[model samples]
Target: MATFLHRLGRGAFRRRRLTLLLWAVVLGIAGAAAAGSGSGSGDSNVTLPGIEAQKAYDVLDEKFPAANADGASARVVVRAPDGKKLADSGPRAEVRSLLADLKDSSPRVAAVADPFVARTISADGTTGYAQVTYKAKATDLTDADHNRLDDALDDARGHGLTVEASGSALAPAAEAASSEAIGFLLAALILVVTFGSFIAAGLPLLTAVVGVGLTMGAITALTAALDLNSSTSALATMLGIAVGIDYALFIVSRYRSERAAGHEASEAAARANGTAGSAVVFAGLTVVIALVGLAVVNLPILTAMGLAGAGAVVVAVLVAITLVPALLGFAPERVLGRASRKKSGQESRPKTTASKLPAAERWAAFVLRRPWQVLLFSVLGLGVIALPATKLELGLPDDSSKPTSTTERKAYDMLAESFGPGFNGPLMLVVSGGDPAATKTAVAQLDRGVKDLTDVAAVTPATYNPAGDTAMVTVVPKSSPSSEQTKDLVHSIRDRAQGVETATGAQALVSGTTAMNIDVAAKFSAAIVPYLALVVGLAFLVLILVFRSILVPLKAALGFLLSVLASLGVVVAVFQWGWFQDLFGLQTTGPVMSLMPILMVGIVFGLAMDYQVFLVTRIREAYVHGADSRTAITEGFRHSGKVVMAAALIMTGVFGGFIGGADAMIKSLGLGLAAAVIFDAFVVRMTIVPAVLALLGQRAWSLPGWIDRRLPHVDIEGEKLGAIPAPSEPGHRDADFTPTH
Candidate 1:
């Protein structure tokens, strides 16, 4: 593998101009294709195929077309500006006129319900809502269509009325453009400080952009043939930037080190590619494996996202191993700067001794001196942070979670204030099969039963289908949609409806946005354990195969688990418990997003393994060269620790930038990922790993002889590079030579 990579790297360096031209061509082609393909809008549907709630929703749509016609409708909410009652004749007339104008002006408007007559007016009579059904889902609407709707809503703002809109269509775009820009800027700053060269700092960012662009283009093309959620692109980009910059940074750092060691540019680049590039390949594969493991959950949305993320990482790896080396070859002199050039001229003789990072070496030695104490302290700290994870609740954020500046949040607040929090997410009860008369009776019975239950705000009269095979009912809870009480209410209604089924001889199925969210939460919660197990188990096995050490893999797995838990616990405390809601501008406390656990587990695990591979491979390499385990650990930390720390900070900055955005989910994701990177890099990789290795001694690298023989060798550290004799060395090392620690 090293030989192949060496040849590839040398060839790339030799053909540097051609390589640059090829990448330029690929970027242009991909950018054009992506622009032409139109990546399409996102899907907010969280329904799992074949689930009971999904089946119920399908039956409702099929049976009661008119009743469900506005399933995707947007609500235009108007409040009397002076706190005047909308029930007054003048204000009511103005509201009615506004609705009429909206209906007449927008071609996309399929129908607009009368606010007063439809009982859409709030109890206070100061606020009213009109339902506007569109020809298609809001996300599917064209730009012109959205502009028309926006204009129509704007017209209603006068006449002493405050108007806001909320629906699937009215959802604020993810608005990741600003966040991405900020992330890039911060990444550049970190790289510049680390490399002390403007040109060197920009290379990783450039490579990341190109690789991410190519992957996004492919994803856009795939969307034409398959269904992908809108969040997939944002998630993919997030992962892509992180891994891309880190991968390139590793190789570039190594190249600079080699050059500093007095190797020629071409030799340095090839050697860097052959060594750090191999670790990049292995780490990239681990990330891909963890992401692809999302398929085990059997949800198309998650599966698509996983594939997209994996694809981006693949591109990152490829760019790091090929394009980065080629680029480095063109300007190796600039990479190390003028100071390095002066030093090189003064010391023309080849460097015989490898330079070590003093700070990292001192830190490692300090930890090793008190191994048990360091390990215990680190474990206890992680444990405290992880405590909140046990009480973690999972639910998708509703429009209520949006920033107050967004139209969705305005509408959500208005509705909750005047009508009730439950008005934002009403449950749909579908009674199918049996006699049409019996279905009606069953619906009536279920409605009556649920109306008297706790949290019941209102139960709309049953509306039966024309075919008499299905009936529908709407149940509104007193609590907000994202509240725990609402989730419990949904369960209670379903349980109560079962009794109605026995009494009326009709099948009762509960579904709606709220119920769908409930089902989604349940599905993801059930899948989390298996998903974590699968990703962890797979990562453990991969580490074992690469490092050929049982204890190393076990230690890595435990550290990953701790890192993930601590990150999640912080999210729960902030987002779920509302410990500092005002700090983050969160308006309400609720469960963390349903998919956060699985997503975090997959991503953080891969990242944890990435550092594991980079750090451990160096230690293993030193050990393979006859260094004692303690010396190997110290030398490895000295070599790779600074690079690991730099990469972690950059990744944390990239993820943290998203918190400045309006989306609650993105904010949670940013916080969780940032926390994970910080804890893993500083605490786990730095303190716990070294301490554990020190205590384990030679046993840390022990692998059964028979299993080691059977396992296929994977040289992630490019050990073959060590076989090449240095220009100053007469031959390979003497068998009796042993360096003092």
Candidate 2:
């Protein structure tokens, strides 16, 4: 591997122009393909095959087309001023006018039902909502369509009526682009400080942008074929930008270090690519494996997200190894500042004793000074932070979780206040598999059984399809959608469904927005154990190959688990328990997103392994090169800690920017990922890992002879680089390079 990378790196250096041109061509092709493909249709709705909720949902979409068309809907909620009733002549006239304008003003508005006609008016007559169905999804809605609705809403407000809109047709505009920009700005700033040169700092950012752009373009082009959800690209973008910059940073930093060591530009680039680039590839593949492992969950959206993210990591690795060296070739010694630039044999290099070591190395020495104390403290502290994970609850985001200022939240509050909390999340009971008459009979019986349940708010009469082969009964629960009581109500209805099915020889299935969410949560929860096993287990084997030690990989996996658990605990505390909710701009607290844990596990596990591989590979390299275990730890920290810390901070900053986003799911995801980077990079990788490795000493790098013989040798330590002589070496013609102790 090292030999191949060494040759490739040197070739790229000599052929820098061609390498750059090839990347440019790749970028241009990807962009053109993405642009020509046009916008794709993506559904955010969850679809789980074989689940009862999915079966019921599919049946409805197939059999009850009118009720389940491929269009979005909105609830135009209206409320009169205090002491006034919408039913009164003046307010009623305004309400009717608003509804008429919504129906007539925009071609996008397929239909709008009158509140009074649909019986959506509250009993008190102060609040009512007209149901408006649009011909297209929110993403498909044009600006004119939005303007038409906004005009009507403004008119209603002018008439002394409080008006708001909610539902799929009125989906909030995404602010992720702004958040991403913020992340880029912050990343650039961090890079400038780390690299200490404008040209050097911009290189990683450029590579990151190119890599992420290519990944996104590919995702856009593949969206329709893969049936990717609208939000899938967000995950891919976040991971790509972060890892892209990070991978480039690692290689660039290594190249500069080699330049400082008095190697000429070509050899430096080659050696850097052979060494740091090797670790970059190994680290990147672990991330890829963990991300692609999302397939174990059997969720299409998650699978797409994982695959897309993995694609980004792959691009990052390739760019780091190929593009970085090529770009460095363009700059040469200019990549190093005057103080850092070294010519062969210009000066004798001082021995790197403890006192002369950098702060990063000193920190490593301090941690190793009392390995047991550092290990115990880190574990205990992380254990304390992980306590909140025990109380983790999962659910999909609902209107109540939106900001109070959002129209969705306002509509939700008004609806819950006027109609009942249950109105927001009514459960649907689908009865089929019998004669029309028998189906109707079964539906009625099921409705009666459901109404008798403790939390049942109301059960609508059976509504049959045109053929009457299937019937649906809407069962509104007494509690809110995210409440435990509502979940219990769903379970109770499904439980009673068994009896109804047996008695009438019919199939009774429970489904609805609420029920589907419940099922999605359950599915995500059930997949966690297996997903962890697959990701952790696979990553463990890869780490063993990289470090060539059983205990090292085991330690890496365990540390990753700790960081992930601790991050999840923090997410739960802030997003669910509402701890410092205001600080994060959360308006409400509920169950953590159903997909958060598994999503976090995959993402954080991959990222955790990133730090693990980069940090441990360095330690292993030093050990392999004849440094004692303790010296190796310090040497590894001295060479790699600044770059690793910089990478972690960049990732943390990028992810942290997303915490301020409007989307609750994105916010939670950002916090979870950012927290994981902090815990894993700073705490686990920096502190606990060195401590444990110090304790293990020579055993840390041990590989069983039998196993070692069978395993394919991965030359991550760049042993092959020895053939390429350095000027500093005794046999080299220059012979000016000084060796540090």
Candidate 3:
């Protein structure tokens, strides 16, 4: 495997330019083709299977034969110019004209509902609404469709009228479009800075662009294959830009370092391929493992996330080797050349004083220069940033009223004004009982409790099949599903109804939107720790065997934990505190997504491993070559610091790009990740890690001599797992021990 990797790397070094151009071209063509194909994407149906939902869909189909067939079940509510005029005559006229236009021009609109003319209203008929419903030819409404609907409504409004648009289709589409562009730009900048040379800088971008392009092409072509999830574009945007760029960065950095060490470009490429390139494979694998795990959720949207996320990672890893190497091969040593001119007859010059200086000389000087001040300041700085996390609230919300436009905003207002403040769906709690009388009595009591609560606006009489073990209660709150009130009701209902059915020996389980989120948090308690232990322990075990170090693994894990904690703190402050809207330009009020933290940890941890390997591997190499602990640590930092910082900056920028986008979910993700990277790079990698390692001194790599001798070295990544030695009485030490301060 090592030999094969080396040969492949060398081949890329030999043929870099042609390879890069080909990948770029392939990526571009595929991207353009996909954009063209995805034009009607927002028009698809959600494909949910339920009688009421289906009935609702059928009603829409029956009413608005003018709507899109292949599109989503789209709806538009026409009010008045002031965003408050909700009456039938004004709304009905507008709905008729809109339906007329739909039927005449693009006849795909499956159905449109005239709720204004037909609805049963209050005794005073002054307040009325016209609802126009249409199905997307595809699945959900894209940003383009939303814009069109908004424009049409704007054009149609002649007098005192208001229009509001709502539904699943419109919101996500608009959110995706804005974010995708910002993410792309940020990722590109990061890639360029990491590889100073244009050729090298372009390698990752090239690979990403191509991989994403092809995947998009496949997504477009496969729209015919099955129902592609509505989040396809956003998914490709994330994976293609993030994992794609990341994979290339790892391989490119390795290749350049190898070439600088004096091997022929091809040979340097080969070694890098065997090492960093192989690591990329593992990194991508872990992400795929975690993302694919999302398949257990049973919701198609999550299934979409799994498919797209895993697919993108796979493509990124593959192209990082095949396409990236080919691109790098074009210029060989020049592909990742340092940012300096080759003077008249000089060799490529070093750009920075740090690069020119010997690693040993620099490490010794820094510690001697700043040991006391550095120790005092670094901890204090990280401590301040971590403060806000203490106030975090992990409860999920039920507000699905994301602002799509003036129409959506108005629609949200109308719903609140006319109907009441609450989500589309409320807490669906089920309490089981024995007989019809008992069940009725239990439901009556529960209804009274639900209605009396300050949070609940209304409670429907229980939907009970008395002979069965379940009685369903739908409790409507006075706020959106994501509001604090809804969360409060979730707690109240669960606590109040836990043992409501003693006669049936049955219990009540609250299982609506609010309950799902609360349960998710509960699940995280048991799940996150074990998952962390598994992955973190796995990473440590691998590092231990690879480097023959006990203290090193402990130190790495320690640093990883501190940085991760800090990231968590930021997540709590921004998401739990609802600070994203004011600070980061995200207008969101959703809870921390149930799966986000676990998935984030997996991705962040894997990426952190990249820096750990690159920086630490260099330090170990210096030690193997006979530098003392302080000297090796300094030298390693000096040598690998630039690439690490560059990588972090680029990644951070990419994550930060989503701060101003429309989607709260995307912004939250980007902000959390970006903050984590910045924290990891500056505080953890540069300061905290160095200090800990310095403090540990020679003990960082210590392992018992007996254990080292008895256990044949196991390298899970180096293809060295075949090495086996008989177990002996386990006692071995790899280095002389020194206790940490």
Candidate 4:
């Protein structure tokens, strides 16, 4: 691997233009492809086991009528340049025009909100919106449904309306993705600023582009077999941008530094492969492992994210090591603007360290001087800033209370205000068995308990299936879906439901928005053990292999655990405690998104591992050269501190950028992820890691020499870096050059 990579790097230096053109073509195609995906129609792949999804679906079928009613979604708000927004009147003209046109066009338009009539337009003249009240028969609410709605909105926007839509799955997604694309590019610019070179800047984004393209393509393919959610699109984009850019940056910086130290391009690429490349491989894998942790929850959305993101990270790391080196080999002599380093050196030059490797002088000086004090203040600061997180509620208003300011939100608000919170009602428990009589008894048993539930407005007629042991029972809450009363009503049903496992063969599970969440939370709570255990176990093994020490893995795992717990604690205090609710602009009763903490840990763990890889790669390299663990730890922090911090800040900006978007889910996602990266990068990686390592000393890399010798050896170190293979490799180095200056 090293020999091949080394040869490839050397050739890259000789043929810069060809390499540039190849990547340009690749990017042009990717961009064109992405633009073509404007509506995100092609991305979907559900990884949840079929049985699980079947169970959820069966529950859906047993509950609400097997009809086509989509619970109401958020409404759209369109404003003109002067704040003159049209609602009922706006959608009226368009709807009527659309209807009149559909007379000549298609039937789908007439069925949608009756484009010419009531559901298509608001009563007011300032806003244009359509209300699609899914009659109790909406069996499918996929992205395509959302896309159709967006197309309708787009038709309106095309005629010179400034549009803001907040409803349907695609509505949030369109807002999320369009904004995210801009953010990824903004982050790319920030990355360029940090690297201070176009090629340097472009390389990470290039890797990111490749990663996203392939991930998007693969995800698009997955939709055929899996039930991948629309949210997965935004997820892939976010992860692709964040990991792709960071992963490439780590390697490129190392490669350029190696080239300058009098090593041939092949040798430099090899060394980069040996050090930064290896770290990247582990970091990327760790991300994959962390993502797989989401599988524990058994939710389709998370399961899909885990699989897709796992694939994305893999692509990112491979490209960082492969394509990046290929580009660097043919890059101009002065890659970092050193006119002479470009033209100098051969394979036999002295082994130079990765440039980001911390030097002993300044690092030891700083750590020894203020080690404990820095630790004290930073940890304290993290604790204080996290104090406000106590008010974070996990629940959002059900589909009934649209979380935006549009007509849908108003409709939801009106419903809640008029109908009490449980207008949606209790969860439907589906049973597929032989006991027609027993199913009847089980449902009756369930309805009686539900009637006994506190704060119930009423239980609707228990429509039962004698043949399938199926029953659809509705239990309306005494309060709105947004109220604590309704949540308690849901809790009562799950705890004391219509189906008793020990007594009856019938299975009764909750399927309403409220009930589904309670089940999701309970299920998520149960998975906590194995999720952490697997993450720790696998990450430990990877860390051990990479650093060649048991102690380092333990320390890495421990520090990461602390950071996650601290973050979770903040989540609990803010959302659970209901403190500072107004300050943060959150609901007092909303709990953290059930899937968020686990996802955060996985994502943050991966990111933490990334910084760990960057910081420790060269430090490990220093150690193999005989530096003591303390020196290595201190030096490692200094060496990669700047780069890791820069990446973290940029990612922080990228994740936080979405807060300005339309959906609260996106805002929460942005803020939560941003917080995790910022804390891990600046606090844990920079200060806490070194302190803990200094305290632990040599234990970090302790492996018996005999076992180490016997273990299967993987090479991270490369031999030649500046040249391509001798006519054997498929790709030739490009002649186009990027000024390293």
Model 2, span 1-741: residue lDDT tens: 887887788778777889999999999999988888757557777778867888997888877777678787889999988999988898999998998988975788889999898888888989999989988776687767777788888888998999998877764565745878888999999988888787788999999999999998888888767768866888888999999999999988988878777678788888999988899988999899988999888888888888889999999999999999888887876677555554445552457676887778889989988999999999999999999999999888888888888888899999999989999999988888658877876877886777789888888878889988888888888898888899988888888889878888888899988998889888888889988888888889898888889999999888988998999999989988999998988878988988778988988888888888888888888888899999999889988898899999999999998897776777899999999999999999999999999999999888999999989988999876888776456775531222211
| lDDT against the true structure, each candidate | 0.82, 0.86, 0.60, 0.62
Residue-level lDDT of model 1, residues 1-741, one tens digit each, is 666686677678767778989988988888787678754565666657766678886786677777666335778898886857888888877888888887875577788988878877777778888888878765566677677678777877766689998876564565645878888998999898888888788899999998998988878866755757767887898899999999999999888878877776777788888888888988998999999999988878888888899999999999999999888866778887665666774553344443443677778889989999999999999999999999998877787666677788798888888888898899888898667778877876886789789898898877767788787788888998878899889888888878987887889988888887788878888888888888888877888888899999999989998999999999999998988788866767777888778888898988998999888888888898899999999879867888888899999989988877666677788889999999998999888999999999999999999989999876766777767665346863322212111
- What TM-score goes with each of the models? 0.92, 0.96, 0.75, 0.75
Winner by TM-score: 2
Error of 3 at 219 (Å): 5.7
Tens-place lDDT digits, model 3, residues 23-74: 6677677667666663444322333222222322343344323321434444
- Candidate with better lDDT, 3 vs 4: 4
Please say which candidate is ahead in TM-score: 2 or 3: 2
TM-score result, candidate 3:
0.75
Candidate 4 segments exceeding 4 Å error: 1-178, 185-189, 338-364, 376-397, 400-404, 424-426, 429-449, 464-469, 482-488, 494-509, 569-589, 715-741
- The model with the greatest lDDT is 2
